[model samples]
Target: MIDVKQPPYSAVGDGVTDDTQAIQNAINAAQAGEVIMLSSGKYLCGPLVGRSDRPLLLTGTVGAQIIAKPNTRTLLTIRCSASNVFQLEFVGAALTSVQPFLASSCIRVNDGLSGVVIQECKVSQFSGAAIIANASISLRVMNCDMSTGQLCVQAARARNIVLERNTFHDLGQSGFALHGDGIIIRDNVCYRAGPVGGFGAVQAGSKNILITGNHSTDGGGGFELQNENALSATEPSGSSCVVAGNSFTRTFAAGIDLFRSGVVLTGNVFNDCNFAAGLPTAFTVQPGIVPDLAGPGSGYQAGDILTLGGGVFTRPARFVLNAPSPNGGLCDPARPATNGNTYVIDMGDYSVFPTNPANVTGGHGTGGKVIYTNANIKARGSGYKSGDVLRGSTGTSRFPVLVRVNIIDANGAVLEAEILFGGYYTGTLPTEMAFAAYDTVSSGSGFTLLPCFGNRYAMQYSKPSMASGGSILGIGNRNVIVSGNSIVNHSPSHDCGILFVNFLNAPVSRWAITGNVFGTFSKGAIKRYNFGTLSYDTAWGAG
Candidate 1:
């Protein structure tokens, strides 16, 4: 028989007492098959522990409430298996806490638990997940009214979980961020899960999962599944996921985003979701967000996608590699200059004096990136390798922007590295963002050459320059299908609906990209590199 009753537990239910010890006492006293009932009132307290041995069922009425202390862990922790918590309001003290956002959880289910049920509860204002399943198995969060938290439910390294009949609204990140296998997320509704841009309403990186009959309205994206090699351990590459019968509305991003292969997305309603970046398609097998290509632009923020303006995998025009002298001035003349590659300079002094006033934005601090353009002492070698100084000078001052070799124009001499100044760079070494100085265009030589040649054979200044073919693609990835979605609006700031990029040198195979609907895109539907030529495919929503 379960010893179920109120009081004697010292739980006043007064709504204004520190009932931490009293509630803990009740949880401790419960034996196997026993339950503790709370009366109608608020129990302001700290963390509570549930045990697997006693298997306590902590039940509360509609008026019963449990609140976490400000700036602390979750209010309820259930690591023990077969533990059940029901019908209680879990409130986070975000209003009365000092920096509550740092580390706080409403409920956390630690690893190695089984058959844990959290049902019919209300969780609000938590800085972290309302329920986070960390390496736990067989956990069920059903019929819960969860709202106003950072990630309402997160399942990382957990398995065989079911989240159903949950109403999540005004969340901070994702309604559900899952990272496990054999998980089922159904009959869940999320409303503008967050205020700003984020991931999916139900996001994950695992296989054998089914996301069906779930509804979400604008927060970040609708549903995203990525093969994040860095996050997963068992299956680094994602596969065997089924996302169907889900409804999305104006999600501010793609309605369904899948970075893995063989993801079957059918019978999904994407209403105004693919409207992000003015795309008309509701499903994506690649990254749907337009990359933040680095160029002469301002107001850049962190996490912005930086890309080479027109270069990724082409035979980049090599910088003249006479090789820097031991003293850092002109190259050692013993080695001749390569005609097409050598960037010869008429140097008076190889001294680097910090005479230019430049500033870069969107880094560690305001203007932390040192900015430099063309200047005196302007001779540099292009024979790049593991052992090479990108920028060397006679004086103590160093070059501003390094690593970023924004070679402009075609095969011409005399570098005008001023293009590097127009970009916001972030790196460790001082020579990371700095570009070597050169002459201007009117000099019949102010040219932009291929700047990145980190690995090449000993040039002793051998190869002049390289003229070769390039490669681009309309889409990347393999064995994916995109069907039936709506995208009505697109941003005029960009020139595409969906731009596919290839970071790996792998081939794209067996891609069944078709049956997508596009609305108003700035430049047709999709654009990519076709061999060495820039090609545009009119398959806006479908490929």
Candidate 2:
């Protein structure tokens, strides 16, 4: 457990007036966890100091106030040798020291440290970082309002840090600088900190992090994974990071910017941010000499499918889906879906198609009883010579019959027919029957039944199956349904069409694709990969 009591030499600072000297006296004599209790009053001070030799606790009454003079250094400076805790009401205290020669910070944890914990403090108005955790390990900062500083918390070279349930406001730099490894920053509200030309730049190059459930607004670039080229000489390997369920809106740039790899960006919201032209990507893989990875060639491999559900992107920007489909990259037979969510793609591209198409001449259509059946069946207006073999049958002949079918009469009065039937034979006897509409004898006369013309119609069992490539169905293993719950609008300036099953390069096995509406006003809808296992069959009818 914690050694909660101070050494015998520890002193107390009566907080009735200028408590700076009394607090310093306590710090000089005491070991860690020594409580410098303050009596209830207004204590004017430049900075209240503590040590990391052991843990220190500073306590005061509920109404006690420790006010720092303006333009002074940090209210509290945490050094490399001490791991202390400050429990007090700090008011108007600039956390950092102002003199250029002196170190300034509300709380500065210097390099080569092992552990420190800062909890349950109300610290505000530090000119520099409220809490600067530099090159340490296991820094646990929880339940603090670190506001009105140039940089709230500058975390560098730390590992296994937990920054939870803190509120940040009106800062200059990032809400929290995550330059450490294996950090968890969750359930924090950071607002109105950095939004100027040189405001709130996020820390660069840290790895194995999990950042989730945080809300940020009005900050310049919500969070960035900055890997400056100079610092990459000592480049920390950045991978296996997960950013999920965070919201970024009303920011100048990306919500969560990425400059590393193996980051699973799932279930986040990027809403109404100034992500217009030339803003950094919310998720970007920087260009470097490709590493010799074991499985995949590039950062993105084939057959890597993703499901984008339960998020919102309220700008007219591209939300990229990285699989191969027809025409674009969506060529897999396993049809994927964009459904079951209330996220709006108000004006952007949503179709996924592959880049190439494949050819297979050996696959023939399912044929009927004839030698070969073409798609065009009605031979009346189609070119057919006399004695053309419509269908072949071995049975004996039945007597011929006559019939007539037409859309209008020569007299122009609407023609009506009673019952007309013929050509009922059995035993595989192929017969042909054709009829035109019965014509009127004179103008506007009642229609009369004309003699059967020499027209020929074939009754046969031979019909070729339609090409499966053109068939888009959402049923069975395909599970493709375009329900009426979506609206897809494509601009006309760009050429577009829907090419299904572009995923042959990265084949899909089974899929449940339902409730997506695609509009192709200009550009194509779907494109599939050229050489992948992408097979897509749609059972749902297209709208």
What TM-score do all the candidates reach, one by one? 0.59, 0.46
Which of the numbered candidates is closest to the native, going by highest TM-score?
1
Candidate 1 scores a C-alpha RMSD against the true structure in Å of 20.2
Stretches of candidate 2 off by over 4 Å are 1-16, 80-82, 93-104, 196-202, 228-238, 275-543
> After aligning candidate 2 to the native by TM-score, how far in Å is the CA of 508 from where it should be?
23
Rate residue 95 of model 1 by lDDT. 37
Per residue, candidate 1 scores C-alpha lDDT tens digits across 1-543 of 222235566676565778888888888887777778876787878888877565658888778888766556778878578888889898776332111234367887778788889999999766567887878788899999986435778778878889998998655446777777777889988865542223343333577778889888754556656554311222335447777777777554456544455556666665555333332211110001111111123333333222211222232111122322232222222222111111212111113322222222221212121112222213323422221112321122211222112232243332322111111111221222223333221223221222221101112211111111000011234565545544344345334334443323423344444565555455555544232233433443332
lDDT of 2 by residue, 44-110 (tens): 6666566646555555555555676655666766654436464566655321111111223566676
- Leading candidate by lDDT: 1
Position 320, candidate 2: lDDT: 20
